[model samples]
Target: MSKIVKKTKHKKKGIKIFSSALVVLDSKSLVFFDHKTFFELKFPKNTVNDLEIVGLENLNEALHKFIKENKITSNNIIMVLNSNLFFEKILKDSGDIYKEISNFIELTPFEEVCSRTIQLDGETRILSTNKKLVTTIKDILEKEGLDIQLVIPYLALDKHSLNTENILEVNGKKDLDQLLKQLLPYNLLTENTVLNGKPAEKPKKEPKRQLFLQERENNPKSKRPLVLLSIFIALIFVLIGLVLFMNRKPPEEFTAPEIHQSMPLIAPIGSDQQEQTSGKTVENTTIKVVYDNNLDSAVLLTKGLSSLGFNSVILEKAGSESNTSKTYIDFSTNYPQSLRDKLIGETNKIFVDTVVQDSEVSDYDVVITL
Candidate 1:
């Protein structure tokens, strides 16, 4: 038996894993899944009114605290907005589809809305939602340092289903799991499918402009030959004048008046002058302020920089792994010292604990990290 016994080993294949987190949001609640755990948060009763998402501040605070406690990184997060908040319709494949979509949006009850369209075999599916709603939610998530990969409407999951009215409504864990299963294989986030609405159409070329140029180029009696003839005649006149001048008698020289010497029109490039010019140039340069926890201070600093004639933008740093104890001013090595001092001064006015350093790898001329 020992001699006849033989064992065969089978190899175990690796399973495909999803590293991204999926978040489903509705007017009432928000559901999050990170491949291993599921969490849900319900909004206050007065969260949504007829006009806007009124509970934005509360929602922002809740999201910030939740993300911090859970230690969720800001990377590869997908947001699915519920279908109840959107206006969905399947439009016929007309020649100008976007035009039709625009008309549809105009006729919708919502005053300002964003739309996304998907073209099927013969029909186009268009989904639109209130612009303010999407913008509010986007700002909230971004403020918490979540890198949103895609903002999609729930109707996109089952576009062809007849009863797609409430198919994507997440009532409990089972519903959320089913929705995730369907969404696992869906990855169509083209320009036309983004929450910002339909992709902008390229400007049509003006045929009249082209026609005018073409006619001028093709005319048999064109002005090119006339111009060349006129130039040739002018050259002949110049040559004749030169010959006359050579044969003429020389004029008597008159005593020239003594001229006084004046200062040079442009002063020499001194070190101090170069530094001043560099400082002026840096004043107009753009400064980027990256913030993690203190958004208010970042906003104030941005405004202050703008007031000082320096164009500035505020960006929320992605992830909670930031040194929030002290603010950092990262300037390029070639950045002028005077300009750096001014930047540091402005930053310190808003953020008290500040540290200045020269960075060789910074993308901007000046980056203030808070």
Candidate 2:
């Protein structure tokens, strides 16, 4: 385990700096810290469903009542979300940390989640929470006119010193206080952190696989096998050419034939016939266009597909709150390769960041996301 550092600022002797209120929220209770003391508010039974606060009105009333009774005046809030609402995994530090994180998220079963990464000594700590849960809490806090400074997971606390089961007990208050003192300096969540229920945009860089290939190609020791293979292939081609040269026949067989032959005439297909054939082929293929914060682009693309004689429909757009910028074209496994190629080519012409993939369980033959 690493030691957490408590940051202290040097100020003039008479200046007073107010401390921000720290609030710990879990499935069972809500703990509020004010003036170096912790206040607990236990939720009623059945109020929480699946680690989410389902009774919004009751929760709001309870929170306001607790604040009034406790006289907690601080508007700056630092929230600590308990483990029940989020998932945590410590991953060994790979050279390509971003790619590793992406792979982990893709493998997870959750479709919509907010994730944050913290770098440790030799590992990366990933904290992912249900997006809906986080969004609900944020909305409640914002509605109360509170400024949420930072939001972190309960895993940030020292496991050895603090008991996870008794997170709000009196015996652990000292340990929890010390941990919060250390965590406050880090400012885990900043303005730039986007936790708006969308996957974070990854920084553009060469993938780890491509970088490894480039490194291998640059190394002289690794080039021997490639050089040998190339030489062997070249030798085979050279021998083949020589065999053809040796088997060459003399060019003394140019005598014209005396017998006359009748050739069958073929009629060229007209434009209308070509149109009907293309329309029939395209009409059999159905396309669904889905968009996230890009309805205009999706509509235009759908119209373009319709004009091209393909059956296209604009599916319900994804949540506008998402910040994903990439365009994706998903084709069903049974979809025709020719149609897939045509759709992919057209999509690429329209969107610069186009990703082509095959979805085995897609309902539509083709699904486009803009």
Candidate 3:
């Protein structure tokens, strides 16, 4: 007997798919809106501790990893900036909106501000943020193959919400409907969203017209002062280079010493002798943690370093003096090309101050100031 043969196709399984990301940025955490489900992630403690400092390098890594592991491949991203993170100012109805915003931002207290403007009905509103934070966010998102569709202030939609008495200003369904309508022209909707029981098509956006919230006016006084300042700096650097070359020291020859039975915990600059100490000495290096007023943090750092197999001491601002003067190696210039790569990689792992000044120390490889 011959049996009829049939082929059956199997569908793919266990793949989580997401079309778009609605990223809500608040002071404490980030909430991602994805297909009727919300995922909230808290910022690590003290990540945004300073108002002026928004260091997101570590957060960027974590976010990118999350997106990759979850198989989220959508390119569209919409950001809702919290009122705490964004600044808003009303621009007066004047001759030039751009010029008014420029003058206003100059007088604002914040440093390195980036701004965007939007005209609603008849009033113009300026949305402002720290330039560094915006740049870092955009760079990270772009690196993850995502493009920012919209960056709107959280409070901007609060006005449209029905419940305005709440301090948090959480919006309702009506506000969301209004926001969706407002962003319709920008084609911010994904393919899965439905309108009238049919899939909504992404609208075609108009061609680019002009740059947004940028200083376009060609004022002679705007950049000439900066140009002159640059020339002055270049001349100063040239003068310093000449002085350093004229006073340069001669190179000294070095010889390797014979191997010893035991290495010293703390050795003199040229001596191989080890000194006896009551406290435990770790390895051949000593790390000093310096702080102005936070001795608690310094102590914590000392304990942390101790756990990491490094001998560390806490330096208080009152009675402690740091000694970093023993090292003779200029990290930037005095290394072979092959060793330079490894040396730079190692140095970057340690956080040093911008202007490093060598202090006096017997057996120290690095000095860190907090």
Whole-structure CA lDDT of model 3: 0.49
- Answer with 2 or 3, whichever has the higher lDDT: 2
By summed lDDT, the worst window of 10 consecutive residues in model 2 runs over 208-217
Name the regions of candidate 1 deviating beyond 4 angstroms. Answer: 1-13, 16-18, 69-71, 93-96, 120-122, 159-370
Q: Write candidate 1's Cα lDDT for 1-370 as tens digits.
A: 1111112231323523335556677666676665345566666655666436777777677777777777766455667777666677887656665556556666555544666665445556776667666667667877778877666665555453412222223344565455545443232333223222233443244323221001223334567799899999999999999999999988988889998879657767654575676664545665777787677777888888877778755476646668468888887776766667777888878778888888888668888888
Candidate 3 deviant stretches above 4 angstroms: 1-18, 54-56, 65-72, 94-98, 109-111, 119-122, 145-147, 155-370
- How do all the candidates rank in terms of lDDT, highest first? 1, 2, 3
TM-scores for the candidates: 0.39, 0.39, 0.38
- Writing each residue's lDDT as its tens digit, candidate 2 over 1-370 gives 1112112234335433355555677767777664445577787654556666678788778767777787666555667777666566786646666666556554443434555655544455766655555656667766666666656665555422443222322233455465455554333333222222223344468333321001222345567898999999999999999999999997797888797658866777554464454452577776788777677777777777777777656467765555667888887765655666678777776799888888977777778878
Per-residue error for 164 in candidate 1, Å, reads: 17
Worst 10 residues of 3 by lDDT: 1-10
Most lDDT-accurate candidate: 1
Evaluate residue 84 in candidate 1 and report its C-alpha lDDT on the 0 to 100 scale.
65
The whole-model lDDT of each prediction reads 0.61, 0.60, 0.49
Candidate 2, residue 172: how far the Cα is off, in Å:
27
